[model samples]
Target: MMRGFDSYASIVFFLIGIAFVWESRKISESSYGSNVGPDIFPMGLGAILVLLSIRLFYEAMKAPKGDSDGKTTPDYKRFLMIAGAAALYAYYLEDIGYVIGTFLFLLFCFQTIQRGKLVTSLVVSASFSYGVYYLFVQILEGTLPGFPSWLQ
Candidate 1:
């Protein structure tokens, strides 16, 4: 199963690399000089991805057969919880404002998922949210959504 997963991932990466390489050719090269063309970064990244995917594919092909059987499967419940939380965060982010939404999301993850104390989770979440807000909005002069109109 693990080898299968690796093989699938490698194939996906290989396809992505091909797409990037193809798309890079369409970018206008007029703005960038001869040496540093518009396609340079995409082409470089695509080449690297292709090479890494080939290496991963080869490794997966040569890996021991029993490794997959011995390894434990990932927890679906935890995956679902995290995904659900992320979806919820995206939905509520603009409405609640960045600080409040982020605080609530972190608190939910810490308390519900990580089984942390309510007070500790709340404090940590609030502190982290405030720090991020200060760094991005206040210090960097980046605009973030203010308190929702309904809340005002």
Candidate 2:
């Protein structure tokens, strides 16, 4: 049987995509002397999201009836931990800087999801956090809170 969660998620994603697309139009249509506008990325992402959500809904609906494997209990505690960590991460991203905030968040999430493998988790989290920072800040020349003002 198809899970109701899948249907709900599809609807949510579809709505979010619609909102993004609609809101993107409010941004200025042209960038100084450039054909590409600031809205292009968001609009493209929204379009992709809309398409993926529709595909997900279609797949959910088309699944064979009575095909569900036995229900498995969700780990609500882990879910809550991750969710809370994510919220905190967002709030502290600017204060602590993207690299530190993301590293801490990812580390917490990794350990929360699966205990053990401390070394692996640390390496992976560090790699991801720094990689994203380097890509966006250095390569793309985008601004992100680097380090706390006190540290700089």
Per-model clash counts, in order, read 0, 1
lDDT of 2 at 137: 68
Considering summed lDDT, which 10 consecutive residues are worst modelled in model 1?
29-38
- Per-prediction TM-score, please? 0.54, 0.73
Give me the runs in candidate 1 sitting further than 4 Å from their true place. 1-70, 150-152
lDDT for position 101 in model 2: 93
Residues 1-152, candidate 1: write the lDDT tens digits: 54768888999999999899889999875342233456667888998999999999999989888657237887788778878998999998888898888988898888657784889898999999989788756765556666678888
Task: Output the number of the TM-score-best candidate.
Answer: 2
Q: What are the runs in model 2 whose C-alpha is more than 4 Å off?
A: 1-3, 28-48, 51-55, 58-64, 67-70
